[model samples]
Target: MTSISMAGTGSGLVLTASWQDTVPATLTVRAPGQGDGATPERPLVEVLTSRHGRDWAGPRYVATSVGQRLRYRSHELTSSGSWQTLSLTQTDAVTGLDVTSYLSIHDEHLAVRSWTSLYNNASEPVTLHAVSSLMFGDFGAADIDQMYLLRGRSDWLAEGRWSRERLRDAGLPDLTTPGRPFRTRGCIEASSLSSWPTAQELPTAVIGDDSTGTHWSFQIEHNGGWLWQVGEVPDGLYLALFGPTDEHHGWQLELLPGATFESVPVSLAIEGDGTLDAITGFRRASRAPGGGPGLPVVFNDYMNTVMGDPSADVLHPLIDAAADSGAEYFVIDAGWYADNGDWWDAVGEWQPSTRRFPGGIGEVLEHIRRRGMVPGLWLEPEVVGTNSPMALKLPDAAFLQRGGERVTEHGRYHLDFSSVQAVDHLNEVVDRLVNDLGVGYFKFDYNIRAGVGSDSVAASAGHGLLRHNLAYLAWIDSLRQRHPQLMLENCASGGMRQDFATVSRFDLQSTSDQEDLYAYAPIAASAPMLILPEQAANWAYPQPDMTDDAIAFTLCTAILGRLYLSGWLDKLSDDQRLMVAAAVRAHRELRDSIPHCLPFWPTGLPRWTDQWISLGLRDVGGDALYLTVWRRDTEPGQVDLTLPPAPDGMRWDYPSAVFPVESPLRIEGEPSGGTLRIVDVRGSHAARVVKLRSVPVE
Candidate 1:
């Protein structure tokens, strides 16, 4: 038998694999000083084909015939700067199929990205039903009962709602009875269907060892269908991540002789501290170069403002107020292109409305620029309204269709970016908007889900959808290349498409379409756990009718992340307007350090009905900490929060000063680790932002 181990230079993670002449290769990952170095019994790669099915009758992805027959062939290790990659090659002798699994990690990140490519070397065709992107056994040394599972659920108005449950409670039973060795057929699975990756269930999960405080977190980096499962096997607990499956998504591909197929990419992060640390590592590995663009304060005319029915007179004052309140970009949301108020179904022409903007839409965009802010427009670029002229003008092949008919949803037809006609048409629209109308930013929104997939020009409907998803990302890359200075925001009915696949590419992500300030607190606080704080655009729509405390509460929700300002700022009194300005100023002062700060939750993950929620951003140096806390309707005037160890001689202060009328904060216990007491004398429905700074003992 031969064994190989690779260690991350700075991450302190170890990957070990073992194989022999008659045994299949097995792989496992663990952090430093975690678990005994036992050889995993499960195979490194799992593949299900039409010819070879599962060896054991179960719903899990492991214990497949092809997976158990794959023997180790060769391995290679390569590195470039801080990044290192390890490729393991395995082959099934009977079927003449080869699998090359690639694992890449950064020296500074305790996360690993994994994927596999399959090549058919036989003479006949190979029908693939499912292929695992990543698989590993013996996740933690503790028993299954002592571990917990964490998952997130998201929707239109409610996004980033996370829940934690024990492994047994999450539907995975412990079948380790003495004398009788039986593996259960059930597993804990989280999956996303159709085009909206994050509409129903988020493609991220975490398994924590309650006794040891260790955590394992993972995320599927796909914009379409994805599935992840955790199940028990004879050897130990196993995890499998995949892009799509024949059973769940009807995704099957036939590989002809010498044909190759690559699986979707997935990431795994491990930490001994807690689940939040694992997530922080995962977020760091998923970031792009320079960690995205600057956090510019954006103001949109939607969500409690004009509510998508904007007119020249209505937008003129809002634009002026947004500029006066220190907004850097002003986006004219939906209905700007509608000739009438009924703009939902007649959208694809990309023309200014004559009735809504009698002076021309250009007038409002020019007004935005005159007030010293970049002009932006809201666009749903991936769909053509059924009643739109472009629906008839574009070729039938340019849109996604199944069974020879166009796929329609919510009065719109999904566009296939693989088609030249579709790309060319959107290219022209964007060029015209940028070159002719002087628009500098775009809020790209997607409002519909193209069911199953498109069967036009592909092996299956699921395959067709997967191809289009990749093409759409490539199109965005090309668009950025053409207009290098332009900023783009990704919005899918408000975060339905909030995945690393999109967040890593877009400048900002609209966290939600949630309109109520009171309910939006938890969503805003939980967003940084999934995406970078600099890229999370939380809306703070403080209206003139809201009280001073309520205005501060809404502003506090946005100050820690990308401040998205809205509401009727023009109608606000002088004091109210100043509060909004103060919030923007505070965000600007701290935005530069946001990209370098790691996120933590002092009060655990927020529940939908939780009265108190807190999110903290700690700097890399551990000297500065910015904490935002929200208190919903409750009888208690103060709440005690458990915080991480602070630097020696550190003191708490309110940095934003937006809530000067609120009570001061108090700390108890030792300076290293203590409880923070936050008092909101105004009581229920109030929020505050405080900073902890290190002071020299003079």
Candidate 2:
């Protein structure tokens, strides 16, 4: 009378575990296609695979009641010869409560991805019209956490900490519609509360909620090559099935065949410290050697290449300069492709510009290596210019076209990702660059979106984006699988694609190449809110008339965090480089050690004058917290800095600097309501990141 037992055989049993626990006493089976001649027997796809993979057999199921939830188990009724593995158990390892309904696990290409689906399934529809109820996560939590909400409708706060309502959208509009396509697709994940419980902390009970039905896709990033996703399914119970979307040959997501009303896949787990099913056979991940966090610097640093400068030496100085300045990456930009055009004759070409690289790209790379930096190259991957060679060589139907002309923008045309053949072609392109060239990084840009009247139109909104991004994922995963070491930065006209989905898929965000005129609020909010501050549009090549002070302030804003130094670092004086160097070093060292990052000093002001300012950072030790305060200009006002959370009974110190004088500010010794006040900060900029120290007592 063991808890675990197998039935008839292990063939249809997709997966099985080595027997251990007792299966439930009673087993219930249902049909997914209820009325139209479907059987009482489970559907052909319901067969469960033991966590051990093909080694064991399980049951296949179909929902008889459509949206009804049911449970089953193996016991006296269930035969003996059955084996079970802990990883795929549908039953509780300890009590065997038939947790299958709450979770689903399946094998797709040997890797098991979990999917979790929640449904109101009762009568009417509900509008999740609130901001707090969104899923927000970036590199650690980057994309729009709140499923693609109605563009200008509700608003969201930093990583969903505290949010107001949103009033506009950067994309097109249809304001009257319900939840826009692409909502929550992931089950609730472990809380991102900024504090790690322990090194081996297992998920006790992680979950996701969407009172308002948005898009049905969410992914919890595992490694660089894999993630979990929910497949298309009608709002139903037990119909929730999940399988790893498999990133082997190319990007793939389980697209539900319309006939079924059940969600094909859902996120679930059975064993271990709650990890994804053991992934196997992916030993081919590509590597770029000298594995590190990744290259975090400039892309296409060649102006001559852009301007048709034939001398490879043109890039020599720039690459060499970037290398010396601690820049980790340098991209060759546009002109390297062999071709002709206003945008670059090489638009359709994917080959190296041998003439431009007079000494060969190998020599240019060797130079960069000598200077101590990684090399990143740019590729539209999914875009091709109509006038380029690849376009002429490729058949007309190979691209996404409009009325007559090739529908495109940003000087390029879209690749028909819907074709497997197209994907294969791109794969070959990736292999040559990543494996053959030893290129360490890429700046993948999507300059145009697929407009109407294209055969490349996706079957589903989610699938459309899925296929579009899938191409890149496949290339990167293949590289990672083969190399297991490298970085891929995703860019779409700067911050255009700066959402969590894209961020989670890549390592960096371009955050727009334009000068951050409204840099204060967004970057200030974005630094700790999403991508690292260093990835923000930090440094820029100013126009001739821009003042030096503006550049200095911009530089200062950038230096305060993970700085991204673009523009002409060479054009600036030695003082500028030294200042940036010090800032970069300080940030690199203090990044993890500091708590919240502040991109801009707050505007000093009394209660209602303009607004109050508060910037605080908790030391990694949790005992110390540093706060920088700002007072509004002109108007005489007192601004308060409310202290952040801290461990109880920890002795803390308060220090302050006001208009040329540094002094000690009083610590009120409170939590939420605590405040630091400064009066009449006239002509005094709210610039401060001073230190405050304390050690927590055990």
Candidate 3:
């Protein structure tokens, strides 16, 4: 093999391409000190077509003939400021398809964003079964036993549950031998097949080499169907990230002559310490600068407060209480667009309800503004209820269909954004809300899953759905262009669609809908692993009837992220109200630093039954560190936490009022790297936020 060309970023990450006379060209990336002795290489892009299928038979998505026939054509490298981009083009003689793969990286970051574009120059049409956005083969470096795979599982109320297992434990066996050679046909895979990307599993994973202390993390940046897999090869282990496949998502695209298609983007990060370090770098490279919408303190009347039944009478007092508590935005959640109480099947027309708001919803919105807060409302724009009047009004072509009938799920028809009428209707609704009602924020919620896809004007149902998904994102981009100052919150029944494709565009993401405060601890602690800390909207619903410790526990859950306040604040007791206010103040004081801070867990990733969970945020410059600790039921009163190097001063930042000197609530530790002991005599259902400041050692 001969090295053709090499490109290196200022971050010390290098990409090298090598080719042999007979074998196809291959590309490999190396970290700062990673020597190229044992690194395995793979093709620039792996693609599968209907006519020419995989060379090796397996359920896996690799070894396609189209990928093997690709020959290196040319490459280009460009740089601008601190960012560098490398584009490598390849061609297949048999298919006459040109594949261009792009890799982008920041000078100061150890991560790369990758995607591929394919153009069909053939005279005949080619049906694509699968196309990988990114594929690499150096994950385990020929040693499968030394690798650990980490994946996250998510659901409606239980989101961000992560688990780590060895390669053998994760269903990939060591099939290599000294005398004989064989490759495994099976792989460890995770995929999403519906509109809710994260409905079952998060589109992120970490591959850690336990022997070398090196970690590699990657995430598929798609809002709809996606698939990622790790499998064993003859040389080593390979990881493939893809948008959708015919086998997994029923997606197939017929590429006509002179047509082009671009795969979804994926981000990869490499670090030498731990999985969290890799995730930190991934978030830094992927998240937008300044963290979207300035990390405002949002108070939405939904969760435990109004429960989707908001009325002017019920919101007036809550609006005043939220404003007094220092909430910057007040959101009137679901049921505001319904005239009658049974609003489940009558949705579609997003007008103010005459019965719920007799004086008009605009009056209530005005009251929110008068209380010194931006007014927002909840909207599920993708679905129109079957009983809604708009159902008859919208054309059949505007909705997802199958077998000449509209697809209905949960008593609603999924709107296909591929239709211009659908997009225009939504544009009118948004314009009216922003122009007339003065709504500055929108909590865009999605409550139904459009199963399989629409088989309308496409080769496959999944292809049609993918087109609609792209159109939906395009609509969001247009919306942002029109209302540049409007803040948008992404919510798919709480964290279902929580992927970078949406999170990178939206201002905030609802973490979960877990109503139990105690049960929400793990979700909040694990949220920053996938979603950016500033965009993670964890709910802190402190009710009037809760104990002081319970209220503090719930408030502490949200202080570390975007403080999404809820609960009946108007009905809270005086002391409880003060605690809530103190939490808000602490968040406001630290929100400026939240966007720049990377997350760390002292006690490891949280488990649902874990007694204690802690989430730490350290600024990029190492100037400030904040930690939130939650003690659940049955936990001991005293627990010691291992700290990273001690800072100058460590003090309780939230619940600003100090406790009695004799009380058992105390934290003691040294100013160096040591363990800190926390004694909370309150025993269970308690939480506290602590701040540590690092000073220069002279």
TM-scores, all candidates, are 0.96, 0.55, 0.95
Per-residue lDDT of model 3, residues 85-186, tens digit only: 778888899999998888887766777788999999899998998998988886535367888888999989999999999989999976777888786689
| RMSD (Cα, Å) of model 1 | 2.2
Clashes of 1: 0
Where's the lowest-lDDT run of ten residues in candidate 2? 129-138
Give the per-residue lDDT digits (tens) of candidate 2, residues 1-698.
22232221312212222222332211121112111221112211221111211111211122212112222333222211222222222332221112222121222212222322222233332211000101111011112233221111001111112122221131212233365552222221121110011001111111222222211222232211222211111221112222212221122322222211112221222211111111111000111232345234443452212333324766776665566566766776655665232444246556777776767787887777777777767777777776677777666555655444555655667666555645666777767887777788776765555532242353323333334444545555565666556666666544444433345456555544444422342333333333333344333332223344344334344433434555455555665555445545544545554323322223321122233344444553445555444333545455555544345765445553211133222223323334445554343333334445553644
Q: Stretches of candidate 1 above 4 Å error?
A: 289-293, 647-673, 696-698
Candidate 1 lDDT tens digits, 636-674? 566677666555665533243334335333333333336
- Where does the lowest 10-residue lDDT sum fall in candidate 3? 652-661
TM for candidate 1 is 0.96
After the best TM-score superposition of candidate 3, give how far the Cα of residue 297 lies from its true spot, in angstroms: 0.7
lDDT of 2: 0.38
TM-score of 2: 0.55
Compute the lDDT of residue 555 as modeled in candidate 3. 88
Residue 698 in model 3: shift from native, Å?
7.3
lDDT of 2 at 107: 22
